[model samples]
Target: MSRAVLVEAPRPTIAAPAAAEETPAQRPSRRWRRAVSPVVLVVAWEAAARTGLLPAEKLPAPADVVAAGWRLTQEGTLGVHLADSVTRAAIGMLIGGVLALALGAAAGLLRLGDDLVDPPVQMARMLPHLGLVPLLIIWVGIGEELKITLVALGAFFPIYFNTYAGIRDIDERLVEAARTCGLGAAARLRHVILPGALPSIFLGLRLAIGAAWLSLVVGEQVNAQTGIGFLMMEARDFSQTDVVLLGLLIYALLGLASDLGLRIVERRVLTWRRGLRAT
Candidate 1:
């Protein structure tokens, strides 16, 4: 007891933390999966075309379509047609989107505005806008104006409805919280409403772009002298199936490209969205 040693307990060894396994990112795998289905479809299509099960006049092989597209590209016809179609769509979308934003904001924020604007819009939406093409042509003539107007009409309602819905759908609690914090109307709208509505707006944007393309398809097909639809029609008259398919492929590609662009924009704009976070 007298010789009690004040020996310190042996210091515990602290083990080093293990390094995290360097797992590869799944991005490349996801991209590979997306490519797989389309590649398989293309292979099957080429194989079927070689089988002669369907006449070549009806469905051209993918290779033939690519060849025809290349030929058109070399001739500079494809560029001109693509440019015209894109210009019409862009102009129409801009006009329609501006109108929609104004109308949607008014209707969504004010009951009187909603009563005055929403019902008529809903009624008009029930009616087929494409059927109005004949009348549109009669009034506007078969020109650039006709195509642009048709695209505008096609794009308008989707934007209007979606924007209105987005605004109306904002959580009431969030609005109350903003009010409790003494936020001014402009501040509340800027910080709360607009952000809340953006996802819906992007959804509408995608749909509207598709609709614009669809309307352009119909408009261009009717008494059109230029654009991809006209090119397809011209090819049809000569039974140039490859060229016709190429035109269709171009339309599909354009629509896909536009949607991809919007998706990129949405991802950038919605970076704060928690659901986008991965574990």
Candidate 2:
């Protein structure tokens, strides 16, 4: 018997199921979760103040702090103090950060540099930079110089240490691969070394910024004429707990602002790391 010719029918292609759309209410957002802690703490604080469990003079309610801050802001005192503090912090961070980057580069890239530079840095880092406030006042005369210098000193070590570690920890195989491709020392460093170490460098930057603020707090105490620390101190003297808390809140806000700025910078610079983001 002759085999019958079979005709094939085209198979249908299946489409992927569409993902469910989340309504505004159902959508998962970080904003609400972020507000949760602050809301809870504020509510608890308010309740405690109202109940007299925590005296207003001692802790002060959130509303009282807000009112105090508003009063100072309107008087322009808070604005001036905030501006001075920000300026000092910015100047100090720049000075310390630049120097640390240079030193870190030397120690990380050159054996001679490492031998000469690392030992002193390691030793100097051991000393409590904050405690040097008294010495700084004596030497720098408790002026802007003292605050800037202290902040610089505080910011320096973290940047240097983290940068050195980051550079040293780069994968050798990548460097070797670049070398095998006839990339010169400078080329290898620019293309391979820096990119690999960027994450750690950003981490150092965040830490350095935080340290700068901490040092500023201490430094501002040394005969500070105008700054957030000064504002807090004046409030403390008058037993204005609300104003003191407001000053602290301002400090926290500044630190938060700086850290957020750095995070944005990190995202821009570390685009290759975008792949690591959750889908």
lDDT scores of the candidates, listed in order: 0.90, 0.89
Best by the TM-score measure? 1
Question: All candidates: CA RMSD in angstroms?
Answer: 6.3, 5.3
Q: Runs in model 2 with CA error above 4 Å?
A: 1-28, 274-279
Residue-level error in angstroms, candidate 2, position 202: 0.4
User: What tens-digit string does per-residue lDDT give for candidate 1 at 40-92?
Assistant: 99989988998997578899788888988898899999999998889888999
Cα error of candidate 2 at position 64, Å: 0.3
Cα deviation in Å at residue 100, candidate 2?
0.5
Q: lDDT of model 2 at residue 108?
A: 94
User: For residues 1-279, could you state the per-residue lDDT of candidate 2 as single tens digits?
Assistant: 999999999999999965555567744575577789999988999999989999877898898899998999899898899999999999999999999999999999899999999999999898999977778777888789999998899789989998999999999999999999999999999999999888888999999988999998888877899999998888888989898889888888899999999998999989888443222
Lowest lDDT sum, 10 consecutive residues, model 2, at 270-279
- Candidate 2 positional error at 36, Å: 1.2
